[model samples]
Target: MEIIPSNGEIFLGKEQSFICKSSVEATMKWLSGDDDEEIEDELGRYKKELIDETTLTLQVTASKVEPDRIIKCQAETESGETTNTEIKIRIIQKPTFVKDVSVTKVFNADSDAKLPCAVEGIPTPQVTWFRNDMPVPLLPGHLSATRDGTLTISKIQLSDAGMYYCQAYIRERNEIEHKNVTVTVNAAPMVTFEEPFPKITSKSNASFTCSVTGHPKPEIVWKKGEEVVSDDGQKYILSSNGLQLSITDLAKDDEGNYTCYASNSLGQQSTTLTLEVIDAPRGVGAGVVAGIILLIILGTLLAVDLTCYRTRRRGFLMFLSTSILGRPAPRVKLEDDLKKGTSDKSHVVNISGIDA
Candidate 1:
């Protein structure tokens, strides 16, 4: 007996077949290893078929194939002699992922971090790493990979924050699988000012803002000397996020050294600003004083005019009273004129004499 396709390899879950033939009619049997008992034929997995009176075929699935397993086809004639041929079966399987990589990882600056990916299958898969769709090298310093397919990073910085991927490649099956993870690096607060030292006019509105950068969103605070600034009343207005200080109707007292403090869980930072308030010009002040003095002089002149008019009117009244009643003329004989019933055109009489 002769077997067709003496050796074969197939992937798991696939079907493989071998044919055996003899010139004369004979009973066909299939055996595995050196077992005396014949191998039983199953319906789908393992099957035995007769092609004519002399040819036999054995069909087996990759799931039934074992390591170093050999199948023998034997033909026994009525004379009690046997002829046999053997076929070797090899099983191959595709790569499969056992553990998926982490979806996301977070680390502070100057810290260490790791990403993991694991896989299992026949013809062991090889693992590779990538960052932001670019291949990552297995280097000695900064970034490296461990034997178990773990990507390690030392002293992580802000620039290292990005998307990372792990890939598993199987050469025999020509298959590749991938897992992705996102890494974030947190940093401390950094404070800066647009205008480091600002010069503003007195009695005008002024606003100072401190720009901040950090992760976890730093909290902002404004300080002057030992006192912390807040929105206590209308004089000072603090921004909602506390990054700005607004002064309405600014005065000379508002001018000073101001400090902005930005802090978070990681660390804190500060920036100082010197505010110079320039007073109004001397010429403008002098004009204002001259205007006030002119108003006072005009008011004094109005008062004096009113007083003089009142004094003149009082003197005129006194003179008219004295002319009418204070002067006494000689007494005329009013009584004699009345007795004579004579008409006297002009006669003067004293009031005391004419009482009767």
Candidate 2:
């Protein structure tokens, strides 16, 4: 007796048939597995048919058939002797997933990201990462796929945010299994103000604009010192797009630091702008007017004294002179002593026009 197929190879979830033929007419029977389980007609997913007196056929369809098993075809002759021919049957399972099929992952920009696609098959499935329906190129540590069905993207960028597929492929069977993965990358806001320190005169109008960049569109906010600034519509006004702030009638109190804050789902950033207000000229005070008047009075007295000394020899300064004893002014005349040969001089006292 001989089996039509020397060895049986069947794919999972598919039917395989084996034929047994004998040289002469004989009774045929089929058994399977190591325990020699008897094969009967129409047993579950297994079927047996007698094609002819010398030929027998067995059909088998099982969900799981792992390792390798033997299917034996037995033939009995009229001499009461039995002969058997066995064939090794192997089941090839198609690629299937053992991990979550629907996956969504979020990663911050410039950080590493991992996408998993765990699978199983008869011949260990090969994993590959795809984007936009194209296979992703291997980029050493930057972008690569591991043997354990993991896809790694190092230093992920903002452009890397998109839909990706982790696919498991069974090349021999041409079977594919893939999982859809949505990747999201978040970037922190970066805020910058062109004019960090701006100057404007007091009682004038001034404006400041901020330039911001980030993912998901950052929200703009303004603050002065530690307090949040609200638009009063008249004194403080914000642009319609909220990127600029205008102050009307700027005062010395509004000359502090103003901060432009930008925030998003990922992170926040802020920049400070110093507002310097120059005060306008003002009127003189009471103290300054009094000092000017005092300077004018002293200047007039000095001019009068100088004019009198040059014009009148006995002016106001000479009238205030007196003797040490508090007497009226005295007059004296100098006389040469030439009449005396010894060059000696004598003084004569005259009080109230009387010589003494």
lDDT of 1: 0.77
In angstroms, the error of model 2 at 108 is 3.8
Writing each residue's lDDT as its tens digit, candidate 2 over 39-79 gives: 77665457889999899998877567567788899888888
lDDT for 186 in candidate 1 is: 92
Q: Give one digit per residue, the lDDT tens place, for model 1 in 187-252.
A: 999899999889998888988999998877898888987689888769888988998898888788
TM-score each candidate: 0.53, 0.51
**Root-mean-square deviation of Cα positions for candidate 2 versus the true structure, in angstroms:** 17.7
Flag regions of model 2 displaced more than 4 Å: 1-7, 13-24, 31-55, 61-65, 70-88, 109-111, 155-157, 192-217, 221-260, 271-356
Off by over 4 Å in 1: 1-88, 186-214, 221-258, 265-268, 273-356
TM-score of 1: 0.53
- Model 1 Cα displacement at 231 (Å)? 9.2
Best TM-score among the predictions, by candidate number: 1
